[model samples]
Target chain A: DQQVKQNSPSLSVQEGRISILNCDYTNSMFDYFLWYKKYPAEGPTFLISISSIKDKNEDGRFTVFLNKSAKHLSLHIVPSQPGDSAVYFCAASAFIQGAQKLVFGQGTRLTINP
Target chain B: AAGVIQSPRHLIKEKRETATLKCYPIPRHDTVYWYQQGPGQDPQFLISFYEKMQSDKGSIPDRFSAQQFSDYHSELNMSSLELGDSALYFCASSLAAGRETQYFGPGTRLLVL
Candidate 1:
């Protein structure tokens, strides 16, 4: 069973607009969430993350919101630039001690119109 | 800054052959992870090493094994490879385990014919 899911395969947004990408998780044990951006022929790079204790976390133009009860999370990029276009993956961990592994969703490809 | 460095950007091998992929993590980082990405699938966890110790391992075949050096560098070795093993392998590093952010290397593309 897939614990994390990104239902949307792709999304398009005009440049300089707010781009919202959504992710959902089924495991109630997951308390930490992260977003990674990947380009073709390259590995994923860490984008932003949010802890369960906080409902929202923002860094520069990127913001991540987490809803514990709903088992959902969303990544918001304001003034989306062309460089922001890539495959975004949502991953979750149970926040346990020691070697807790991550569960990743399929991914959502974000496109920015010039 | 050297985020993460993986060797042999690409590998082409025959079935039943042996393949080894190497990774160097960020300086001062203590944990290394191996992940495999297949077509239309998200990168899946394979194994992780912390301080030369095996920390977390996923449900992968016994042919897949990994080792970590004293300096935190790691390698993934696959023996008796099969045609179905063709995919992209990624190496990542983190300060510790659990929910911390992980830095990634470019990745190695392996093709088993």
Candidate 2:
């Protein structure tokens, strides 16, 4: 069963516009959430993260919003740039056997057009 | 600025053959995690280790085994590989004492014929 889901397979946006990607999770035990951006044939790069206790976290042009009651979270990139075009994955972290385990979404491919 | 390292970025093997993948975590990191990603699918966690000991298990198969060395490197050994085993294998590392942020390797692309 897929505990984390990113329903949107792909998204297209104009350069300098805002882009938003959504993710949902079924496990309430997850205490930490993170977003990673991956380019073709490359490892995922860390973007931003939020804790279960907080509703929002921002870093530069990227922001993450969490709604615990809705079991949903979103990543917002303002003034999207060409370099921002990549696959975005949302992952949930849960502690099991005193170690952190991550569950990832299917990933959303974002394309920024100039 | 150093990140996780994985060896043999690509590999090809026949069914029933064995393959070994290696991962070297960043200096001073204490935790290692392995994941497998099939085509058009999300990454699935296979196993993890912390401080040279097995810490967690996931969807790993009986034919697969892994271990972390004292030097903080890990290896995944797959035996009797099947066609379905062809996928991208990723290794991630983090500090057990830090927040849950895992830095992933570039991934090893394995193709089992």
Candidate 3:
């Protein structure tokens, strides 16, 4: 069962434009969420995260919005750059599974075209 | 300081063979995790280790196992590998057991024939 899901397989955005990726989860028990970015032949890097208690968290050019009622979250990148082209994964963690174990989404491949 | 590091970036093994992957966490880190990423798929959690003990074992098979030592490094061992085991395995480290930001390694690509 895929507790976390990213319906979009891929998205293309022009450089300097905004890019938004969405993720949904079925498990309400998940209290922590994280986003990761990965490039070809490389491991995923920590991008951003938010707790269920917070609605939004922003860091530099990246912002994560969480809607607990909807069990959905989104990552927005402003003025997308070519370096932003990578696969984005949304992950959720529950206390039952321990904090270190994460359930990842299918992943959304984002491409920023100049 | 350098981020999490992994060794033997690539490995090829035949069926029924064993493959071992290693990971070194950042200094002072407390938790280490193992994940598998097959082609066209996201990373799947394998297991987690912390405080010199096993913390979590995800939906992985008995063939897959992990070990942690010295608070700095960990290992993932696969015994009697099958062709389906071909994939990229990743190692990640976090500050503590509770909710935290995890730094990841470059990943090891394993091919089982």
Among these predicted structures, which one has the highest DockQ?
A: 1
User: Sorted by TM-score, highest first, which candidate order results?
Assistant: 2, 1, 3
Model 2, range B6-47, lDDT digits (tens) per residue?
988999999999999999998888999999999887889999
What range of 10 consecutive residues in model 2 chain A has the weakest lDDT sum? A94-103
What are the per-residue Cα lDDT tens digits for candidate 1 across B30-99?
Answer: 9998999998899998998999999988856799899999988999999999998899999999888767
lDDT of 1 by residue, A1-114 (tens): 999999999999999999999999999888788999999999999999898999999999999999898999999999899999999999998654578678899999999999
Residue B102 lDDT, candidate 3, scale 0-100: 80
For B9-80, candidate 3 gives per-residue lDDT tens digits of 999999999988999998899899898999999888888888878988876789888889875699998999
Q: B105, model 1: CA deviation in Å? A: 1.1
TM-score of each: 0.97, 0.97, 0.96
Could you tell me the TM-score of candidate 2? 0.97
Residue pairs that clash (backbone atoms under 3 angstroms), model 2 = none
Model 3 chain B weakest 10-residue run by lDDT: B63-72
> What are the fnat scores of the candidates, in the order listed?
0.91, 0.62, 0.79
Query: 1 or 2: which has the higher DockQ?
Result: 1
Q: Can you write out model 2's per-residue Cα lDDT over A1-114, one digit (the tens) per residue?
A: 889999999999999999999999999999899999998878788899999999999999999999999999999999899999999999999886587879999999999999
If you score just chain A, what TM-score does every candidate get? 0.96, 0.99, 0.96
* Interface RMSD in angstroms for candidate 3: 1.5
* Full candidate order by DockQ, most accurate first: 1, 3, 2
